[model samples]
Target: MIQAPGKLADATVPHIITELPGPKARAQIEFDKQWTSPSVPRAYPVVPVRGEGCTIEDIDGNLLLDFNAGIAVTSTGHCHPDVVRRIQDQAAQLIHYSADFYLPIYAETCAELARIAPMTEKCRVFLSNSGTEAVEGAIKLARFATKRPYLVAFLGAFHGRTYGSVSLTASKAKYHAGFGPMLPGIFHAPFGHVADLKWFDEVLFDRLVPADEVAAIIVEPIQGEGGYIVPEDGFMQGLRKICDKNGILLIADEVQAGAGRTGKMWSIQNWDVEPDILVTAKGIASGMPLSAFVARDSLMTKWGPGAHGTTYGGNPLACAASLETIKLLEGGLMDNARVRGEELMAGLRAVQAKFPSVIKDVRGIGLMIGVEFDSHERAAAVEWGCFQRGVLVLEAGHTVIRVSPPLVITEDEVVIGLKLFGEAVAEAATKV
Candidate 1:
C-alpha cells in the first residue's frame, strides 16, 4: 500500500483492473440474493467493496470511478479520513442514547448546522435518522406552526418516500402507488412558471385554499430524483415573495443538492432566496444515517415537547461523522467540487453538441448533473454502455442520465468517466 499523504494528491484518476461486477462480485450477488430484500437490488449491479477519492473497488478487485456518489450521499468521498476517524473515536466512546437523553455531540452538531444554514440566528433544529424523516418533521412543523391545512409543492418535485413526504413528492406515481389517502390539504402547482405570479396574487392563492389557511410551500432548489432540474431565474425568489405575501413558510429540500454538491453551502443560495425551513440529509455525515430539519425558533416553538421524536435520531457516532464531514466540505474539498464540476460540465456539453439526438440535454449547476435522452431506452442503453466500459452512473426522471460524482472526484477521473459516458452515448446512438 502507498504511504498516505497528509495533504491532497496532485494526480487523481481511476485505475481500473478487472471488468465491473466480475467473478467475485457475481458470487457475492448470488450470496446476497439468499437473504437480502428484493427491493434493495432494483437498479445497478452490486460490486463496491472499497472506495477512496472518486473510485470504488469491487469484490473482484475492479476499480470503477464512482459518479453516482451513493446517490449524492458521499459529497466528501468514500470513508474520508476525518469522517472515519470521528466515527471511530466517537464509536469507541459512546454510540447510542435513544435521543431521550441529552448528548454533547448532538447539541454541538445542531449548533454548527444552524450556523451554516440560512437564518441561523433564529433557527432551531430537529434531528432524524434519514432524509424522509426530516421531510416529515418539516411538514409537521409547518402545519403545526401555521395551524393551517393547505400545503403546496411543485410538479416533478421529490421530497421523500415516506407517506407525508411522498405526498409532497409529485415526481412519480410508483412512490405513491397503493398508498391511499396521503396527507390532505397538500396541493400541486407548476414550478418555474413566473407568468403565473399575478394569477397567484389575484386568484389561485385564495381559490386554492384561502391564503389564510395555507401552511407552507416545500420545494427543492434543484430537483434530484425528478432530474437535475434547476429552477428558472427568480423562480425561487418569487416563491419566497408569495410565501411572504401569504404568511406561509418556504421550505427548501436540499437532501440531494446541498452541502457543496452544487459548489455552494446550500443550492438555494445560488438563487439568493432563503427558506423558512431547510431540510438536508444524504451527504451530511459522509455515510452515516443523519438528517435534520432546521427552522426559525419562533416557527419551531409551535410544538410542545412530544410533537416529534425518533429512537436513533441523534446518535453520537453519526453526529461525530457529520461534524467531520461538514468541516471537510467547508474546507478545500468544496473548492475542488467547483473546479472539477466546471470541467465535467464542459466535457458533457461537448458530448451533447456532438450527438444531439442521443444526448437530449445536459444541465446542472455543479457536481449534481443530468444528461437527458430522447427516450428511456436510449438512456438505459447509455447506462449499460458505461457499465460495460467499467464505469458507474444512474438515471433520474423519465429519460435523464444522472452523473453526480463525489465532490472529491478529481479532474482526471472525471475525464475518464466522461470518456466512458461519451463512448456509451456514441454506441447507443448507433444502436438506435
Candidate 2:
C-alpha cells in the first residue's frame, strides 16, 4: 500500500477549527463569485487547501472527510503517492506532445485499458480530455461506423456540457434551456423503467425513428447525476439483445460509474454485458483530465484516418498518471470498494430504518451509493447538516444524496463518516 504524505499522516479528520466559510474561504468565494461563471454549481463553501486520502483541509485549517471525491473522480484517493510519483516523474520528462503523434505512454495507457476493457474481443481506445469529449467521440464513431443518423439516450442522463454531449444529456432542462434545436435525430427514453424499454420497441421504433437509422443507445450502467439508480436484473441484457438484433451500437456511459467505482473495473461488467462502445472518464486517471471511449477493433477500424482527434487528449503526464491509477485499482482498491461498499450500504439501511419517512430509498452498487429523501428540501437539509458536521457530500437528481468516497477509504473512515451522515439525516428528518 502507498503511504500517506507526511503532512496528512498525523492530521485528524473531520476536524473543524473555525466556522465554515471562514475568513479566508469567504474572501476566495467572494472573489470567485466576481470572476467565475455563475453557471458553475457550488455545493458547500468549504474551500480546500490540500487533501490526502479521503481527508480535505480547508483554508481555515478545518479538516473535512471528502465523500464526494470530486464527484467520484478521485478513485484512488487524494494525492496517492504512486499516482503523484508518476505525475512528477512524467512531468519532468514530457508534459505535452500532440497525441496525434505516437507517444510511448499513450500506447501503454491504451494497452493497459485493452486488458481491462469490457469487450471480449480486442478493443481500441480514443483518448480525450474529459468525459464529454469521450462521449462526443463515441457519437461520431457510432454514426460513422454504423452509417446511421439517429441516436437514443435515457432521460436524466448526464453525458457532458459540450455541444454534442449537451445535446445528448437529458438530466436537466436548464442544461438545454435556450440551447435550442439540439442536434437532430436524438430520442429520450425512461431510465431503469422496464415499461420505457418496451415502449422503445413498440412505440418509438415503430412510430418514430426506425431502428435501422439509430446509430447508438447511450446509457449509464448506473445513472449518476440522475439518482445513482441501479437498473433491475436483465435490464442490461435486454438492451444488449435489442442492440444486437437491430445492429445498433450500445454505448455504455461509464463516466461516473466506471474505473472501479462500482466494485468492478467497469460497471457494465457487473451485468456481464459487453457494450459496443464504452465511454469513461472521471476516475479513469485518478483525477487527471483524461477520458477515453473504447470499442471493438472491428468498429474502431471503420473510422478513417483524421476522422476525429484532440490536441491534448493523451498528454504524457495524464497517461503516466493513468497507468499508476490502473495499477492501484487492479492491485487492491477494487476489492476495497466492494468490501467497504457493502459495509457502508448496510449502515445506510440501518439509518433508513430509523427515519423511514425521510429516506424514501437507498440503493447502489459498490461504493456508488445513493440515499433518496421524500423531498428535495429534506435532501438539501441533510446535505447542509452533513456539511456542518465537516463531512462533504453531494446531492443527486431531485432528492438523492450520493455517497461516492475515494475507493481507498478505510473501514474506520467509513464508520466515522456514516455516523456523521446518520446524525445529519436524523437532524434533517426532524426539520421535515
Candidate 3:
C-alpha cells in the first residue's frame, strides 16, 4: 500500500477472510433486532472488526475496499492513527461530562472552526453530538435571532431525521412518516432547476412563500441524499440575494458535503456566496461524534444561556479528535481528495459512456459522487453486484448510486472499484 503524507494512518496492508457479515455479524444483527428500531435501514451485512487506511475488515474475515467512507463520515479513512491516538489519549486523560464547562480542548477546537469558517469576521460556533443536532440548533438560532417562525428549505434536501430537521427535509416522506405533526411554518421551494432558472427567480419564490416572513433559507451546497445534485452557476448567488433582501439567515447544511469530503474544506466554498449560518458534521471529527452550527456572533447571540445546550455536546474527547482531524485535513488531505476525485470521476464517466443503457448520469464534485440510473431496481442490482464482487458502495434517492470513498484512497483502489462497478453494470445490463 502506498503511504500517504501527514501520517494520518498506519503503514499497513489490508486482507480479507470471509465474504461479509460472517456468522459473527449475523448473530450480532439478531441481537440488534431485539433492541434497535427496524425503521433505521442497514445497507451492508459486514460487521467491521477493524479498519486501517482505506479498507475495513469485517467480523466474517472479509476485507472490502471502502467506497462509502462510512456514509461520508470517515473522509480521512477508517481509524486514522492520528485520530485514534487523539481519541485514546483524551479518553485516558478525561472521558467526558464537562457540559459546556471550561475545557481547553473544546475552546481550541471551536477556535480552529472559527478560523476556517467561510465568514469569520464575526463568527462563533456551537458544538453538538451529531448532524441532526446541528440542524436543530441552526433552526433554533435562526428563528430566535430573527424572531420569526417560518423556515424556507429547498425540495430534495435531506437535513437530518430529528423533528426540526425532518420538517426541513422535503425529498423523502418515510423520514417523517408518523413522526409528526412536524414543526410548522417550514416552506420548500423547487431547488434551482438549471432548465428554468427564470422560474426559480421569478415565480418559484412567490409560489412557495413570500420572502418577508421567512426566518431562514436552509440548503445544501451539493444536495447529498438528494442524488448529489449540483446547483447551477447563479443559483447560490440568487439565494444569497434573496436572503439579503428578506433578512433571512442562509444556513448551509454541510453535514454530508463539507469537511473536505468535497475538494474544498466545505462544499459552500465552491460558490461565490457565503452562508450566514453553517451546519456541519460527519467527517468533521474524522468519525468522532462531533458536529457544529457556526454563524455570525450577532446572530448566534440569540441563544441565551441554556437556550440550547446538550449534555454531551462538545466533549473533550470529541474535540481532541476533531482538532487533530482539522490539522490533518488542512495539511494535505483536501488536495488528495481533489486529485483522486478527478481521477475517479473520469473513470466513472468512461464507464457511463460505455454502458449507455444502464448508466443515465455521472455527477458530483470532488469525492462526493453519484451515478444515476433509469430506475431504483437497476440501482439496487448494481449495488448488490458491487457488494458481491468486493467493493462497498451506497445508493441514494430512487435511482442514484452514491460513491463517497475515503479521501486517502489510492488511484489504483479507485480503478479497482470502477472495474468492479463496470462488472456490476454489465451484469445489470444483462438482467435488464
Candidate 4:
C-alpha cells in the first residue's frame, strides 16, 4: 500500500525507496497517455495518490516532499486541516448555488475581499472559477467603464488562455500560433523596465495605438510563467503613473504572486503601488478552485444588472475554503513566508556559488522564488534531479526552476529542501 503524508509539513524528507514512478505509477501513466488529451503538459512521472501538509505519496508508495505546492496553489499546504474542515462543513450545508441570486457566503467572501483590497478606493469583487475568467472579467470591466478600445500588456506577462486574456498574453509565441484574429487594440511593452513605459508613450503611442484610447494596462507585479522576475519599485510606480496619465486603469495580475505568498496581502503591496483593478487566484483558496477580480467601487458601479453574472463563481465550498485560507494567511503564514524565504534564498545563492556557470540567478520575494540556469537543458536536468531526489519542483520561463513551496513550509523543511536542491544541482552540473 502507498504511504500517507505526515501530520506535519516538514515530516517528510527526500526519500526514493523505489524507481521513480515505480510499477503502479508507470501503469497509470501508460493509461493516462491513452485517455487524456495530449495537450496537457506532464512535468515529471510522479503520480500522487495521497497528500497532507507539505508532502505527497506517489502511487508507487514513495513519499515525496512537495515544494511545488501543486503549482503554488496550496497556500496553507496540502489539505490544510482548517481549510478542509471549512470546505467539508460548507459542502454539508450548501453544495452549489448560482450567484444570480443572493448567497450569504458569496457576500461574505466579497466583503472579505474588499477588506483586503490593495486599491486606494473602496472596491467590489467579481468571483470566478479560475484565473482565466478573472482576467477576462477585469479586462471587460476596464473596457466597459472606460469605453476605450485599447489595452496595454507587458511582453513577458501571462494573463490567461481565454481569447480575451490570451490576447493580452505575450509570453510564448506558441500560445498564439494556432489562434489568430486576436482581440484588436491590444499592445505589448517590454516588462520590468521603467524606461519601457517611456518608450511605450513615445514610440507605441506615437506610431500605433493612442495612449488615451487604451482602457487598461495589465501587468504581473511578479512575472510567474515568464520567470520569477521581481521588477524594481520604480518600474511598477512608473506603470501606475503612465496609467494615471493616460486615464487608463492599471490591472494587477496577481494570480501567482498574491494572497500573502509574497509576505504581503497582495504582491503589488511589496512595490507600494496601488492598482485600479486586481486579479488573483492560485493561492487564494488553499487548494480549491476560486478566483476574483476586484475593481474600484466607482468603476464597478458602472455595470448594471445583466452586465455580468456567474453560475458557480462563488461555490459555497470554495468560499468557505477561501475564508479559512485567508485567516491562516493573516494569522501568521505570511510571516512564515518572509522568514523562510530569506533562508531559502540564501541557500539557493550558496548553491549558485557552487556551480556558478550552470546557475545564472536566484530571485523572488517571500516564498515566490526562482532559480534560473544558463540553459533550458540544464534547467530540465536540475528539475529531473530534484524530482528523483523526492523534493518536487517545476520549471518556469525558458531556463528557470520555480521554488514556490507552501506558505506553511517550516524552517526545518526549508533546510531539507535546500540540502536536496544543492545535491541535485551538484549532480546536474556534471551532466549538463
Candidate 5:
C-alpha cells in the first residue's frame, strides 16, 4: 500500500495577508485578462502562487482556504507529499513514454482501477488525459460496441465543451448556440423528473428517437456543473432497467463526482447500479492529468487497439500519481468524505435555516454539495463575498453555490468554511 500524503490541512485558514486582489494579483489579473481567452470564467480573483492541502497562497501573499480544489481535481489536496514524490520518482525514471508501447506504471494504474471498479465482472481500463476525452472515447466505444446510432443524455448535465461531448451537453443553450448541429441522434431527457424509466419508452421513444437505436444513456451520478443535484434512488434504479430493456449502454460520467469525492470510488456505486462504461477524472491523479473509462472486459475487446489510442493518455508520471492517489483515497479519504459530508451538510442546513429566503436548498452527498440560492444574483453575491473573505468557492447551474473542498479538509476547517459561508449567506439575504 502506498503511504497517505501529509494532509497539510489547517483549521484556522484564510490567513489573509493583503487585500483581496493585492497589487501583484491585480497586475497579474490584468496581464492574464489581456493574454488569456475571454471564454475562461474566473469566479473571483485569488491568484494562487502555491498551495498545500486545503489552503492556497496567492501571488499577492494572501493565504486562502481552497474549497474549489482546482475544480475538484486535487483529491489528495494540493501538492500531496506521496503523490508528488511518486510523480517526481516517475519523471526521473521516465517522462514521456509513448502510450503506443507498454509501461509498467500504466499497467499498475489500470490494475488498481480494475480492482476498485464498480462492475461485478472483470473490467478493462482505458486511460485518457481528461474527463472530456474519457466521455468522447466512451461515446465512440458505446456506439461501436452496441452498433447503435443514437445517444441520450440529461437536460442539466454538463458533459464537456468538445464537439461530441458538448453535443450531449444541455446545461446551457449557449454551449450549443453557434456550435450548430451537435452530433446527430443525441436526445435530452429532463433529469430529475424522469424517475420512472417508462418516460423514455413513452415520451422520448414514442415522439422522438427510437430507444432501440440508442447506443447509450450517459448520466452524471450527482450532476456537477449544471448543479450538484442528486437524483432520487428510484430514478437511478429505473434508469438501469430502461437501459436493460432498450439495449442501451449506461455510461456514468463521474468526472467531477468520482475519486472518493462522493465517498465512493465511483458515484454510481451509491445507487448500486453499475454502468457499462464508467468515465472518471477530476480527482483521479491528485492534480496530474489522468482519467479512465473502465468497462466490462467483454465489451472492451471489441476495439482492435489502433481503432482508438492517445499519445499521452497513459504517461508514466500521471500513472504514478494516480496509483498513489488511489492508495490515499482508499487509505482514509473516502471515509473522510462520508464523515465530513454529514458535518458539512448539517452546517449548511443551519445556514439555510438562518437565511431561508436566500437559500433554496442544501443538497448532495459527501463533499460534492450545492447550496441553491433563490436567485443567481444572490448566489453570485455570496460567491464573491466568500472570495473577498479569502474563502474560495465556485458557482454552478444558475443559482447554486458549490462547496466541493478537498476530502482531506478537517472538521475545524469545515467549521471555518461554514462560518464564512454563513456570513456571506446572511449578507446576500439582506441584499435587495
Candidate 6:
C-alpha cells in the first residue's frame, strides 16, 4: 500500500508557528508583485517554502494543511517520495531529449495511459505540457477526424486559457472579456441541464448549426472552476447517445476532475458513457507539467504525423513522474480518496447544517468537493478565515469553497482539516 511520508502521516497539522503571511512571506509577496505578471490571481498570501504530503510550510515556518493541492495538481500529494525519486533518477539520466527524438519513457507513459484509459478499443495518447495544450490537441484531432467545422461546449466549463481552448471556456467573463473574436463555430449550452441538450438537438441542429457540421461536444463531468456541479443522472448518457447519433465527438475535459481526484481515473467514468476524446492534466504527473489527450486508436489515426506535435510534450522527467504517479494512484491512493472524500463530505454536510444561511450547498465526488455559500463575499471571507487558521482552501466560481485535498491525505488529517474548515465557516458567518 502507498503511504504518506512518516513526518506528514499524522494528525497535528495546520501548525501555525507565526502569524499568517508573516515577515518573510510579506517580503516575498512584495517582491513577487514587483516582478510577476499582474494577471496571475493570488487567492491568499501563502508563500510556500516547501511541502510534504498534505502539509505546506510557509516562508515564516508556519505549517498549513493544504486542501487546494496546488489547485488540484498534486494528486499523490506534495513531494511523494516515489514520484520524487522517479523525477530525480530521470533527471540524472535524461531530463529532456524531447519526444521528437523518441524517448523510451514516452512510450512507457503512453502504454500506461492506454492500459488505464476508459476505452473499449485500443487507445492513443498525445502528451502536452498543460491542460490548455491538451484541449487544443483534442480540438484539432476531433475537427480533423470528423471533418466538421463547428463545436459544442457547455456554459461554465473551463477548458483552458490558450486561444482555441479559451474560446470553448465559458466559466467567467473575465477569461473572455477582451479576448475576442474567439475561434469561430464554437457554441455554448447550459451545463448539466438536459433541456440544454434538447435545445441543441432541436433548435441548434435544426436552425443555427446543423448536427452534421458539428465536430465535438466538450464537457466537464464535474464542473470545475465554475462549481463542483455533478450532473444529474442520464445527462452524460444522453450526451453520449446524442454524439453517437450525430457523429459528433464527445470530449471529456477531465483536466481538473481526473487523475484519481474524483475517486476514479477519469471523472467521466462515473457515468455509463464513453467519450470519444478525454483531456486530462493537473494531477497526472504529480505536480509536473504534463497533460494528455487520449482517444480511440481509429479516431487518433486520422491526423498525419506532423499535423499535431510538440517539442517537450512527453519529456523523460515528466514521463517518469507520471509513471510513478500512476503506480501510487493504482496502488492505494484512489481508494484512500474515496474513503476520505466520503468522510470529508459527511463532515461538510454536518457543518453546512449548522450554518445553512452561510453554506448554500455541499457537493462533490471523492476528494474533489465544493461547499457553496450564500454569496461571493461570504465565500471569500470563509476562505480567508481558513487561511488565517492555517488551512489553505480555494474559491471556485464565485461562491463555492473547493475542498480538493491531496489524495494521500490521512484519515486523521481529513478530520483535522474539516474541523478547521467548519471553524472558518463559523467565523465567516458572524462577519458576513
lDDT value, residue 124 of candidate 5: 89
In model 4, state the lDDT of residue 15: 60
- Ordered list by lDDT, greatest first: 2, 6, 4, 5, 3, 1
Residue-by-residue lDDT tens digits, candidate 2, 300-321: 9997779998899988988988
lDDT of 2 at 351: 97
Weakest lDDT window of 10 consecutive positions for candidate 5: 1-10
Write model 5 residue lDDT over 217-323, tens digit each, in one string: 99998999998999877788889988998788999999999999989888888989988999988899988889889999999999896988999998899999899
lDDT of 6 at 266: 87
TM-score per model over all chains = 0.94, 0.98, 0.94, 0.97, 0.97, 0.98
What do the candidate models score in CA lDDT, each in turn?
A: 0.83, 0.91, 0.84, 0.88, 0.88, 0.90
| Candidate 4, position 277, lDDT | 94
Give lDDT: candidate 4, residue 117.
88
Where does the lowest 10-residue lDDT sum fall in candidate 2? 1-10
State each model's C-alpha RMSD to the native: 2.6, 1.1, 2.6, 2.6, 1.8, 1.1
Better of 4 and 6 by TM-score: 6
Looking at model 6, residue 185 earns an lDDT score of: 91
- Judged by lDDT against the true structure, how good is candidate 4? 0.88
For residue 143, what is the lDDT in candidate 6? 93
True-structure RMSD for candidate 5: 1.8
Summarize candidate 4's per-residue lDDT along 1-432 as a digit string, tens digits. Answer: 111334533355656778997989999999999999987878999899877777888887788888899998998888887788899889889999789989999999999988998977998999998999999999999999999989988888888899999899888888888899898889888888676677776888899888888899999999998888889769999888888888989999999999988899899999899999999898999878899999999999999988987899988988999999889999888998898889999999999999999999999999999999999999999899999889899998899999999888877779988999999999889987
- In model 3, state the lDDT of residue 397: 88
Q: How many steric overlaps are in each model, in order?
A: 0, 0, 3, 0, 0, 0
